[model samples]
Target chain A: MSIILDHVNYTYSSGTAYEIQALKDINIQIEDGQFIGIIGHTGSGKSTLIQHMNGLVKATSGAIYFNGQDIYDEDFDLRNLRTKVGLVFQYPEHQLFETTIFDDVSFGPKNQGLTKDEAGLRAFEALKMVGLDESLYYQSPFDLSGGQKRRVAIAGVLAMRPEMIILDEPTAGLDPKGRDEILDLISKMHDEKNITIVLVSHSMEDVAKYVQRIIVMNDGSVMFDDCPSEVFKHYKELEAAGLAAPQVTYLMHELKERGIDVDTEATTVEEAKRSILKALC
Target chain B: MLRDITLGQYYPADSVIHKLDPRVKLVGTLVYIVSLFLFKGPVGFLVITAFLALSIKLSKVPFLYMVKGLKAIMILMIITALFNLFLTPGETPIFTLGPLKMYPEGVKTAIFMLIRLSYLIVGTSVMTLTTTPNQLTDGLEKGLMPLSVIGVPVHAIAMMMSIALRFIPILIEETDLIMKAQMARGADFETGGIIKKAKNMVPLLVPLFVSAFRRADDLAMAMEARCYTGGKGRTKMKPLKYSGNDARAYLLTFVFLAVVIVLRIYNL
Candidate 1:
C-alpha cells in the first residue's frame, strides 16, 4: 500500500570517465490512493526518481520497497511490479506503433498473459475511460491528432489496471485546452478509481489545481514535501532553485505585501479568489 | 544518464603525432597497415614492431588503451588461428588433436596470424584515438579531393559522413528513451530466444526510425535555409598544411617500409 525510497543514491556510469551522480540520497514515501505532484527543474532527478518506483532503473546504493516488498531482491518479480506501477512518459504518443488504436491500447493487457477476448474487452473499457470516441478505435494511431494520440497511449497504460500510475510531463507540448483535458482526465481517475497518481510536472499552476500533496526536488534531493498550499509558501526558495510557485500563490503574496489583509497561502486560483473576496467584503 | 556514452573514442592530448596534419596520419596509417602485410618473415616483423612501438610512444596514448581495441576482435583472431593451425599442409608433425594433425609450420603460421591481427587492430586504434572525428572527416575530404576529378562528389560524401557521425549519438539517446517507454508498457526485452529478442526490437525500432527521419528532414530544411550549397568554391576556416614533424613522420614511415621490403625479398 506504500512505496518508500530509503536513502537512494544513483550514479550513472560509475567507473567511466563520464561518471555522474543523477540522484543523491533521496528519501520519500508515497501512500496509497493519494494524488501527489512532483515538481522539479530539468535534471533535478525527478525522472530518475520515478523510474525507481517501478524498478526500471535500480538504485546504485539504496533500497526501494514497493508494497512492503524489497524490489532489489534477486527473486523479486519486476515485470509484475511494472504492471502495477504503470508509467507514461513525456511525448507518450511517440510510443504508439500498432496499426489500430485498439490494438495499441491492448498491447499492455496482452502482455499480462490475458486471453485475447479479455484483453480486447479491457482495452475497450480503458479507451472509453480515457474519453476517446469509438469512431477512432480502428484508425492508425499515426493518423490521430496530437492529443488524441496521447489519450490512446494513456489508454494503453490504463488497461493494465495499475494500482499506482506515474506520468512524467504528460501535458507537455500540448495546447492549453489539451493540457487541461489531460489533467482533468487524470484527476477524474484519481477521484473515481481511488488510484494513486504521481504526476511529475514542471507547471506549478497545474499541480496546485489538481494535486493534494506536492514534492519539490532540487539538485537530486527532496527540497520540500507537504500539502500544495504549504509547499507554495516557500516561494522565495523555490524561485532561487530555478522554480516558482503558482501564479495565484505569487499574487496572494503580493497582495499581502501591499498591506492588504489576505491569506497568502492559497495555491490555486479558485482558493485565492475566494480568500481575496472574503477579505474585501 | 544514458547520454554519457563516449563516442568516437577521441582522447585529447598534446604530442607530436596529435599535432601532425590529419591527412598525414591517414596516409601513415595506410602505409603502416600495408607494411604489416608486406613483411613475411621474423626479421621484417621485428623491424615493424619496433617502428610501431616508437610511433605509439610518440602518439602519447597509453599502450594498454590501444591493446584494449584488440578485445573486440579476440574471437575472430582465435577462429582464424584455429583454421590455420589445422588446415595448412606441412612436412613435420608435432601431434594430433581429435583427428586434426598439428605441425610446426601450422603452429608458426597460426601464431604469426594472431600477432598480425593484434597489431592491425592496435595500429588503427592509435590513429582513431589521437584524431577527433571532425579532423578525420576533414582529412578524408581533402585526401579524396583527387577522386573528385573522376566525379566522386567528394564534398557531398564528406557532408554525409559528418552528418551521420553527428546523428549516431542522438539516435542512440532516442533509442534508449523508446526502450524505456516500451518497458513501461510491459514490454520485456531481457528474456527470450534470438528470434523473440529481435521481435522485441520492433517496439524500439519503429519509434527510433520515425525520429531519425524527422531529424534528417529538419536538418535538410535547416541547411537549405542557411544556403548551404555543394563544396564548390568553399573556403576552410583552418586549412591543413604540412609541418616539419609531418615531413619527418613520412620519412620514418617510408624508411620502415623499405626495411620490411628488403628483408622480405632476402627472406631474412
Candidate 2:
C-alpha cells in the first residue's frame, strides 16, 4: 500500500486576519513498511504535513490517496482510514484518561466497534508490543512514570493495529534513558511487525541511526527527500533551513576539509569511525 | 476556527483611553453604566450615547470591532426585547399578532430595553478592551482597597481574577490541541447525543485539568522561589497615581451624571 499526497496545500483560519499558510504545495509518496524520518524546525509544517496523511486535518486544496482511493471521497470511511493509519501526537500522555492502562489503550479499539474481549486482547498485544509490563496494565496511567505513561499512550494507538503509524516528536521531553528506550521499542516494532513508520523528530542523530529515508522540511516545503547519506551531503542547505546533519556527519566533513581523505557522507558515528580508520590505513 | 473567539479580547493601540490609569477607566465605566440606568427618556439616552461615542472614539478601537463583542449577548438582548414587547400592556395599540396585542408603551419599552442592553455591553467592553489584564487587576486591587478595612482579601481576589483571565487563552489552546489529539485516535466528538458528547469530553477534560494543575503548581513554586509573600507590603513598579487627566475624567463623568439627574428631575 502507498500513501500519496497530490499537491497538498493547507491554510489555517483561511478567511480570518490570523490566517497562516501552514503547508505549501507538497507532494510525496510514502510506501508500505518504509521507515521514514521527517525533520524540521518549529512551525516548518512537519506536523501539518503528517496530519494530512490520516485525514485528521483536511488539505485546503489537493487530494490525499490511500492505496489508489481518495480519502476525501464521499463514500470513503474516515473512521476506517484512521484505524488503518494511527497517529501518536506529541505529549501523547495527555490523551490517556481511562481509570486503568488497559482500558485506556483499548479505548481506540472499542471506538472501532470491536467486541470487549477482542478489544482487550488487542490492548494486551499492543501493550506487550510497546514493552509495557502486564502487571502495570491494571494500574492507573496517571500513577506511572513519565516514560511509562507515554508508552501507555502509544499503546492506546497501537491497539488499533494500523498498517502505518506516525509519531510526532515521540521522545521529546524524555530523559536520555527514556528517549533511548522509546526509540528502541519503536525500532523493534518496525523490525518485527514490518509496519510503515513515519517518525517526526528534531534529532538528526536519531534519524541517521534509525530511518531508511529522510525528509527535510523548510518553511512549509520539502527541501530534501532522500536517504540519510545523500541528504546529509547537503549540510549547508540543511543549516540554512534551521537544521543540521548529525554530529558525525559534521565531524567527517571537518576531517575531509583538513585534507584527510574521508567520506563526508558518513552520517552515523560507526560509519564515520570506519571511514576514518580506513583512510588512516 | 475555535481560535477566532474574540469576546472580551483586548485591542492594543496608543490612545488617550489606553494610556489613562486603569483605575480611572474602571471608575469611568462604573459611572457610565450608572448613568445609563439613571436616564428617564430618549433625551437622557441621547446624552449617554454621546458620552459613549466620545469614549469609543478616544479609545481608537474600530467601531465594527466593538460591535462584534455584542454578538455574544445578542440572544439575551432579543429575549428581553421580546418579553417587553408582548407582555407590557397599554391603551395605544401599535399592532396585533395572534392573541398578543402590541401597544405603543410595549414598543417603547422594548426599544428602551434594547438600547439599555446594547449600551451596557459596549460601555463595559470598552473598559476591558482598553486595559491590559495586569493593569485591570492592579486597578481593581487599588479601587477595592477601602474594603480592606472590612477584613476582605482584596489583593488575593484581584490576583485570582488576573490569573484566571491570563489562563483563558492558554487553556483554550490546550483544549483545542487535546481535542485534536483525541480526534486522531478515532474519537468521534460530533454527531453524538448529549451523553455521548460529554463522554467524549472526558479524554479532553482530564488532560486539560491535569495540565492546568501542573501549571498552577509550577507558577506557585516560581512565586514562592521569588519570595512572593501576600500583598501585605508588596509595592508596585507603577503605583496607581491620579493625574490631571484622571481629575478631568472624574469631572466629566460628574457633569454627565448631573445632566442625566437634571433630565429626570425635570421629567425631560
Models 1 onward score TM values of 0.91, 0.90
Report per-candidate DockQ.
Answer: 0.58, 0.55
Question: lDDT at B200 for candidate 1?
Answer: 86
Over B8-60, each residue of candidate 1 has an lDDT whose tens digit, in order, gives 56767898989989998999889889988888888888998898898799989
Candidate 1 lDDT over A21-45, as tens digits, reads 9899998999999999999999999
- Expressed as tens digits, the lDDT of each residue in B145-218 for candidate 2 is 99999999999999999999999889988888888778777898887899989988898888899999999999
What Cα-based lDDT does every candidate model obtain? 0.89, 0.90
- Stretch of 10 with least lDDT, candidate 1 chain B: B1-10
Model 1 chain A: worst 10 consecutive residues (lDDT sum): A11-20
**TM (chain A), candidate 2:** 0.99
lDDT of 2 by residue, A44-161 (tens): 9999999899988899999999999999999999988998899999999987888999999999999899999999999999999998888899999999999999999989889999
Model 1 alpha-carbon drift over 4 Å, by segment: B1-7, B11-20, B39-74, B241-268
